[model samples]
Target: PGPLSPSPPQLRAQPQGAMQVGVQARELRQPMAMAMAAAAPGQMVMSAGMQQLAMLPCIDVQERAQWLQEATALLGAEIEMANKYRVLDQVGNQFFYAVEKTDCCRRQCQNGLCADCTSWEVDVLYTPPGGLMQKFLALRRPCSCVCCCINRPTADVIDEATGQKIGSFRDPCTCCSLRFQVRDASDTDVLVVNGGCCCTQPGILCPLPCGPCAQVRFDVEDAESRSTVARITKRVPSCLSWFFAPDVDSYHVTFEHIQNPQWKAIMLAFTIFMDFRYFNVNRNQEQARDVLAEL
Candidate 1:
């Protein structure tokens, strides 16, 4: 579609309860992990496991937030780039149209020279969708100038050689794609669901220190002027175990998606580092057990 003027798009109905429900479930899991840790303090092994799982939710939250922020910033940058191009249809362009006081007096006044009026009223042509026109409307109050408050006039596209109006321009329609899938450890148990309102690209894997096992799908409404929504889910069982565990150990860690763009990459990298740390911790534990056995 040609660039839509900056006038607010029509709002659509939103999937009201879904996002909140997912958030609440995520939040609830944290306290549940804490309770488990308290109950299994003597079982240091179990407590540690639970704590590790608890950390996953926290990490997921942080990561998600970070990605959301980054994505929003990127959206802003895209808009700015469009503005820099100054590409607009006739109805989407706005400009200042000023006439000197003398010209106004000579054209409209009974006397050729209107001595009382120092300046002529200036009319500003404002278009919709484009940022420049929006800004003009915001800054300039309503006035009597003919151009200042006029609706966009239609223009016919005429072929210079043929001297005929061409009817080739067509408005573009909005379209989107969304997909969801779950894969098991062997990567063989792949279940795919396709066709939704959002994009279908796979999310980055932020593996927990433990490992990956199951993936879940999540859907949420897009934050556009239009109330478009989308769904996506990735589950790693190893990560889920850590997310659900109750006790924290030196090796415990969590993976969260905090809606930040860079967060997914950062969290994924952090999780890989934590996995190495977990391996070292396990090696140390094994060595200590051997010594105890010998003693």
Candidate 2:
């Protein structure tokens, strides 16, 4: 028989770096129109202040071979996983990379920033399987202040090349268990984030524990049915990781077998956010001091 059909795209590898884009506020209205048409009777009703948002471009990764090649080139030996990634950037200081949870650069210092510093708006480069190097995603953390500290701090999800606003992850508030929204251009809610516990343990998760470590379940849901599409189990760093070294917070995100690339990307962004919320909360002060001095 002739050669069998090519394998599907392997989406196991995660992208690194980030890109910036120009986002127009008006583009968010399209998805709401589409969603409203499909919403159940009572579900489409919006409150007086509600708004509409756009949906992300449809991304299909079923092509296994192509996806695998891209994953290998970008992640390099790291296993490819959908919706699972570790926070490669540090906190308190600007500039960092969101490396794959499996593949990471161990070099002490590359470029001007060390491997352990917090990153701001880093570009994620990708070439697809047979494509050329292009900006994939950019991680950006906006500065926060005391007044807005308790507010659910959010990270802007920017499309590096076009500077378009693909989507944004609104983190859970520090004080409450309120729902968060993964919004698109029109700020329309694409995925609803609800039902999860936060990681409040101060130290590590080992022999000498500062506090009990619990995994926060970040459940991403559909805007209509409110059914779960993906879930991320996030836990605090270990004692050694928290105090001594810079480590990516431990977490696992799993998506439904058939998923949209846009949603997958949103889930990945959540992982990055969780990393900042958990590990960075217990940031290494000494490291922060040194990082600040370097700036």
Candidate 3:
């Protein structure tokens, strides 16, 4: 007991870089004796070695590996979200460009070649979603003529047998008329519902009376090859009824009006400027936490 109190060996002061060297050795798994020997001569290495040993219980290798894996997966998800946002932003920009370029009404058709401009009666028809065949029809007057004489322009969808009209386009035009049918999976039947002379009486240009305009037929093969189907005729009059009348054709305008609100909201939500703020804020928060932890 007397000699036991002689005490442990006096510890020497640590060298200037001994702490860094010990940290490196711990990370590299060098033998303890070799690491202590590598320290500067007369430097007390026991405290550094003891400190590293004490850290071993608190250093969770498994937890760190799990954290790295989670971080990688989160980064992948963020990148995917960014890509989707980019695509949505592009679509919004395109829609804005289209709206900006479109002309308002009468401004679109200053030239007598109303053919150069889109008509109010015109419609872009495509096969309803989920339909078998994809068909698009741009139906409008063949010529630029306004019809004034006809009192009652009507359309009658009749059963092929007995010539009975089933459904009709209510408003009739004296100058031009159009009707379309998907004849089969591969063909379409286009009938000139009405025809009139292309008179010089000029209010709206009318397609001059052309013979039954032939059965303006279209093949699905042609449509698939060309990607478009358009027909212009001037036989029907450009009656105010054509534009203002409540009829099936008016459905085009109605559909456009109905879709406007939903489309506008969708476009606004996906804009890049709107998304950038959230992305930047989240990134800054993550960086701040990382810095604090490192410190």
Report the number of the highest-TM-score candidate. 2
Write the residue-wise lDDT of candidate 3 on 98-129 in tens digits.
01112344323422234222222211111222
Global lDDT of each candidate:
0.23, 0.41, 0.21
Root-mean-square deviation of every model: 30.8, 16.5, 38.5
Question: Model 3, residue 166: displacement in angstroms?
Answer: 13
The Cα RMSD in angstroms, rounded to one decimal, for candidate 3 relative to the true structure is 38.5
Question: Model 3, which residues run further than 4 Å from truth?
Answer: 1-107, 110-133, 150-295
Scored by Cα lDDT, where does model 2 land? 0.41
Cα lDDT tens digits for candidate 1, 128-225? 33324311100111112222124211112221222222211111122443332222112221122232442332222322443221332433322222
* lDDT by residue (tens digit), candidate 2, 68-167: 3223323323222222232221121211124332222321121123322323343444433343544456666554432444545566765453455666
Name the runs in model 2 displaced over 4 angstroms. 1-119, 127-133, 144-152, 172-174, 198-214, 235-243, 283-295
List residue ranges in candidate 1 displaced over 4 A: 1-50, 54-176, 190-195, 198-217, 220-295
Write down the TM-score of every candidate: 0.16, 0.47, 0.15
